[model samples]
Target: MTAKLWIDSDVCMSSGRCVADLPRVFRFDDEEIAELVPDADIDAEFDAHRDLLVAAVRNCPAGAIHLQEDGVEVEA
Candidate 1:
């Protein structure tokens, strides 16, 4: 399943886990908040790295990472 992913910067704590762990899918903005990488093919990433993506979400200290499939929030 193709899932949509996003980071809630307001809730992000600059933990850097996602950015460090999944550079292709996430990066830190100028303000150091995590954000999705520009032009990232989230679907393909999800397809190829489902386990890693889920782990990232589960490991995010601020719970700022989010994934949704079919309009429902994924539970990591």
Candidate 2:
């Protein structure tokens, strides 16, 4: 199974790296903070763009992005 990803907005620094890294999944909300699109299929996105998502998590200065699979948090 793919890892389902999400962002912790409170921890986000509006770096935009996630947006730059994965447009299909991450986007800037009204507040300009990086967040997942409302209708995004986290599992599918993760499956397709695992590399981009990994880059996002690695590039996010605030370390706000995270993933889960089967209710267990993913760390990568």
lDDT of each: 0.90, 0.80
Q: Model 1: clashing residue pairs?
A: none
How far residue 51's Cα lies from its native spot in candidate 2, in Å, is 1.6
Query: Per-residue lDDT tens digits of candidate 2, residues 1-67?
Result: 8576878889999988778767878899898988788888877877777777777777788989987
Candidate 2 local lDDT, residue 65: 92
Native-vs-model 1 lDDT?
Answer: 0.90
Model 2, poorest ten-residue lDDT window? 67-76
- Clashes by residue pair, model 2: none
Tell me how many clashing residue pairs each candidate has. Answer: 0, 0
| Candidate 1, 29-73: lDDT as tens digits | 899989999999999998899888989999998899999876888
What lDDT does candidate 2 reach at residue 27? 90
8 Cα displacement, candidate 1 (Å): 0.6
